[model samples]
Target: MKISYLLILLSLTLGTPSQIDVSEVRTAYIKASGDEQAVEQLNSKLISVTTTDDKVLVAYKGAVGTMMAKYAKGLKDKKSLFKEGVSLLDYAVTSDSLNVEIRCIRLSVQENAPKITGYKKNIDDDKAFILKNYNSMTDEGAKKFVKGYALRSKVFNDNERQLFQGL
Candidate 1:
């Protein structure tokens, strides 16, 4: 009985998924742009996320994957990582089309993605979506996250940035 209980306890501990804090992910994401270590750490934390997990978490997983591509040494590995990330991001968007946070995440990725990657197609659409729906977001944290990103996004012109002011 002791051995069986120990086995069960070990299995339970090993099988449990790590808990993701969305706020921490958001904060890490902001740091990732300038810090490769932050990107690697966030990617490691999010690597276990699957399609069945929360859509927002899936989106972060995708975002970190894309960021990881920047640190990849080989061109093939970089392209592969980017494509996989974009695929996951697209899946999350499809899963929750109306989620403004997801849209913001995609916009951040697309805006910064190289033009040669052909992943820039959604920039205009996502920008428009974010602009139109940003005010409707009920979560203060979500609003702050979006506003923080928009304030720094190159895609948002001076006039557009004004919309997110005083948030």
Candidate 2:
């Protein structure tokens, strides 16, 4: 009985040696879209994951960059932030071209950005890709995040929402 109890306790503590999970990290990031406080929290998390994969880091930075771009106070500040964010975003996507979650982040940013910014090119393709492979995602939180997004945003049409059914 003592040995069984010890084993269970060890799993609770050491089973999750890595502090961050990709799905959780990605979800926290998307939730931080316009909130400055959330963005700051995200930056803190991003910094602590030095040993994490480059793709995940890139995606987190891209999300943080977008938030900074949207909230930076001055025109010059905003422009600079936009440059940084877009650079990170491109780098992340290039590094992991087939990552559906990263593409979802880009889609969310572009769909809501001002029309004059010319960042709306991939909405259709991303929607198609996300829908095509969404069911295969192993992370339940990630699935819920995408489904929540599709339900709340103007990015998807009625027909598209139907496709995202039971997500």
Candidate 3:
């Protein structure tokens, strides 16, 4: 009975915004790869995830819209998604210059997206920003998450990877 209650309580508290874990969020994202339904569900969660009137919250919401665009096939659909995502990301970084995680999300989207979409323009600048400041992020989880993603990304060259790994 005690174990049952503990499990229930744990479940209840874990979903709360205050308890939201970004590392776990990133892990779940990685696990959901190639799973359409899982991606949709996770994207929905990102859209709904709460933040304290902060850039991270805005960025997550924007990222969800961007993910929705990823699954969209039409040119118009992708355009709409890109606009919302990029705008939110820009707003986030503008509001909080130190939001490396938010910038990471924006950079990832821009770097992988095609050049025709006009979203790739920030790829170099965001990469430079991330490389320059990521090591100094106070959040250990953020640092680890960014470094892991940057290492795997083709957008970052050997020098960038070396910088990430060195950190």
Candidate 4:
């Protein structure tokens, strides 16, 4: 009975499940016809992603890049947003291209476009690194960090309200 109890305790102790954060991006729908409310809504959503994690910052920066790229040909003289996006993108990429999801978000932004000057090799390297680290990270907090990055990556669009989805 003592042996059996010890074996059971060992199994129970060793059976702890791996940790991960399940985050969702909240989505809303606004006018694609360039309404102020829609733009405001998108900006609000983007603003909400401001957090402490360096990875989240990088991911949000990528999202900002995508938005600036989309609105570049449309906005009248608001070169500010585009400039901000460029700065953020450069900062994030330089800070750590090993951030896979952030790099992926950057790629989805317009960096992958043929006319753009972005390179795929950087993204590929980041992706590989992220996957390797992700697979190896068993800590709940680290997993949550990765999930948050992923959540931020998918939470934007050319439309204004698309930014608020799944939150």
Candidate 5:
């Protein structure tokens, strides 16, 4: 009886899924743009997950999926990955339209997506939304992460970038 109980307890512990950290995801996202390893790491972490209930995680999952397209070998695979990533991202946005971080993630993807993908439609709207909502955000970590991305983004011109510089 004792052995069976111990085995069951061990199995239950091992079967529980780990919680993903948003801050860690944010850090990985920043590195993912320039690092293929970061992208791969994020992909592996988020690929099999199937729910968008956690909006931030789903958004990062989408962003990482989109970024993975650049590393894909074949054109078809590239398009498939990009499409899947964008689909997840869109779902996240629809689920939580007012989440600034989600909008920021979408903007990042849209701004960098190729014109051929036709995924650039939301750039202006997302950028405007982010700018308008940024200062009002209460999560300092999120604000800092978004500001860091904005500083390096091509869509945010000199004057626009300045808004994120001081604070």
Candidate 6:
């Protein structure tokens, strides 16, 4: 009961300006388990997910839409499923710059180990952008955003180097 209340409070208080699909957010949030790492990831993702269909949002959007679309296609299609998962991961990271777990999850999304090398550049780009801009954010209400960003950078740097190396 206490956990449920906490989750609700977190969701209500942290909601972004864009209309968040509450049900979808809840579905994603519950997967966090009691693990601090997963919770951190979910917290980041909440900020990035937006309901507005704007070009800016779409440009920065990752693989979430593709992943959700593919998931809707069912599990029988292995190739599609794998690609979709990767896309979702990309979206998750794109949406929540602070969610570091998405970086870790990206590892399992790629089938070929060699492809990991290719992704290094992208990850490096992300890291540069994050490190460069995060300091500019100063609003007290957005401290959680800053915290999440730092946490993601540390985790991705330490645990998911292949993904972060490209940035």
RMSD, one per candidate, in order: 2.8, 7.8, 5.6, 16.2, 3.6, 10.9
Candidate 2 residue lDDT tens string, 38-126: 88777666653332356656666666776777778998998787777767777777777787777777778778767766878888888
Report the poorest 10 consecutive residues by lDDT, candidate 3. 45-54
Compute each candidate's TM-score over C-alphas: 0.89, 0.76, 0.76, 0.43, 0.87, 0.35
Instruction: Indicate the worst ten consecutive residues by lDDT in candidate 4.
Output: 17-26
Best by lDDT: 1
What TM-score does structure 6 among the candidates reach? 0.35
lDDT of 5 by residue, 1-167 (tens): 99999988875544322456678888888888869998998777665455534887888888898999999999999999999999999999999889999999999999888889999999999999999999999988889889998999999999999988887
Residue 29 miss distance in model 4 (angstroms): 13
lDDT of 5 at 84: 93
lDDT of 6 by residue, 14-50 (tens): 7653655533443443344334555444445544554
Off by over 4 Å in 6: 1-78, 82-118, 138-146, 152-167
Question: Cα RMSD for candidate 2?
Answer: 7.8
Task: Put the candidates in lDDT order, highest first.
Answer: 1, 5, 3, 2, 4, 6
Going through the candidates in the order shown, the clash numbers are 0, 0, 0, 11, 0, 11
| Model 4 C-alpha lDDT versus the unseen true structure | 0.45
User: Regarding lDDT, does 1 or 3 come out ahead?
Assistant: 1
Which candidate should be chosen as best, given TM-score against the real structure? 1
Q: What TM value does model 1 have?
A: 0.89
Q: What is the lDDT of every predicted structure here?
A: 0.89, 0.72, 0.73, 0.45, 0.86, 0.42
